[model samples]
Target: MKWVRSKICGITRIEDGLCAAHMGADAIGLVFYEKSPRYVGLDQARSIVQAMPAFVSIVGLFVNAQAAQIKQTFDYVGLDLIQYHGDETASFCEALALPYIRALRMQPDVDIAQVAKTYVNARGILLDSYVPGLPGGTGEVFNWSLIPSLDKPLILAGGLSSTNIAQAVAQVQPWAVDVSGGVEQAKGIKSAEKITDFMQALRANR
Candidate 1:
């Protein structure tokens, strides 16, 4: 478990958030992107974040939202980290001050080294599948071989299920892995069994 962090995203329900924490999620992502089916309002997010046990982080997901909007969300939810999942510039991301990650939409032969350099100051970089006209949470993985050797921490995401998570952990040995649709019964709904299975797989690999 040297580098096996995991994030459970698209959490809309308080029960699901609690379950993720109880089952040992390193962090929980609350989607603030309105267009996403997994989006949760500030009030709901506030309640869930407030109830989480200590050391389990609360991450807020944004997609090209304004500075004021991000500030509002942070004020209301008190996020431990922010995840930018759209075409946000490094300046926009850096202005937040709070720790954050810039997601790179993985595509065929994308220059990951350049991408990492562009956001060098970010807490980490999240590599996810490239899906046109869609936000994150597609549950479609990109070619893992495309990952370039880099100095920064990489967060592996997309199409990660319990069965393949151990394999992924062994191959990429990423700083963290993110899951949303892969462990879901439907959009915004999660399965506790899937969560347990995914963690078990990660542990077994360790």
Candidate 2:
């Protein structure tokens, strides 16, 4: 619980990216998925990445995108990690030069352990809530009790905010926690005060 890292996902602006990094976020995520409201285009994402200080990772979220496109974006944005939110296969995930984390929408039949084994090359495994048609950013919490002991590092997401983050950390004790809408002023905009509060609450966990 004490060492849990935090990642502020769905960053669309350079100021938000800098705010998250300066406020002690371990990482800042950039959404490349066009369907997502928080989506950042190649030029915008590049600008954000360029302005970010070192030690704060930049993660690019892709939803079943083409291999070439992923490669191009990965190179163009100089992303530190690739987050796969759709139905990408293990080989497909590992084929890239950069490391990645596979985000699983916690559906009924999902076997977290099996997935951990299958995506052996993944740097970490992220668990998010399930919606009927969405790949990620569902903003709904799943039954954490259902998560079993696993081999890989777990990154918990879905509906995490300043209010319940401490409890979620105490319960799951994940390697890292990712939040999007939780610290937002709007769909694609971030609230610095909310981000600070969320990080402070997370740090207060013991």
Candidate 3:
């Protein structure tokens, strides 16, 4: 039997945070990138984190933000982990000294194996779809066939929802699956029904 963990990303409201945690999400993500439609302010992020029940991991997502900014967020939000979604170097990520995951956009020229080697300290490697101007949450699926066996845990994101989660999990068998827009009623706002449906689909598949 396989166990596929689920993460509900881009949680903004306290209700949404509680909903995701109550829906059996192993983790919940908060976007700190200002440009993202799903971005959460520091106060909002802190309140969401405070409202969450125990055992649900909180992940703080950032783009190519200044080190001071990330440090401030880490301190203020009390995140359990950090996720680097921009072109942060392995050394820079390591310097933060927080347990972190690296979001890798599956672009044509990306060397997955080499990247895995470069950030060997990442707790997991998240694979997201690549759009020319977007970092993540593009709501587009990448070619699962392009994925190769990796030495580290592989987390699949991008375009995941109740509609396709079962098939996606059956095919890739990732360490986890992350969803944002797919489970939202709008950007940064989560839909309770959609979240329940998505988790049910994933659990049934596993």
Candidate ranking under TM-score, highest first, comes to: 3, 2, 1
Off by over 4 Å in 2: none
- Over 95-143, each residue of candidate 1 has an lDDT whose tens digit, in order, gives 6676888888876567877877877578889999889887688889788
lDDT of 1 at 106: 78
Query: All candidates' TM-scores?
Result: 0.96, 0.97, 0.98
lDDT of 3 by residue, 43-71 (tens): 99999999999999999999999989999
lDDT of each structure?
0.87, 0.91, 0.92
The RMSD (Cα, Å) of candidate 3 is 0.8
RMSD of each: 1.2, 1.0, 0.8
Error of 2 at 20 (Å): 0.4
Which stretch of 10 consecutive residues in model 1 shows the poorest summed lDDT?
107-116
Better of 1 and 2 by lDDT: 2
lDDT of the structure predicted as candidate 1: 0.87
For 61-132, candidate 2 gives per-residue lDDT tens digits of 999999999999999989999999999989888877568999987788877788778887888889999899
Quick one: best TM-score, which candidate? 3
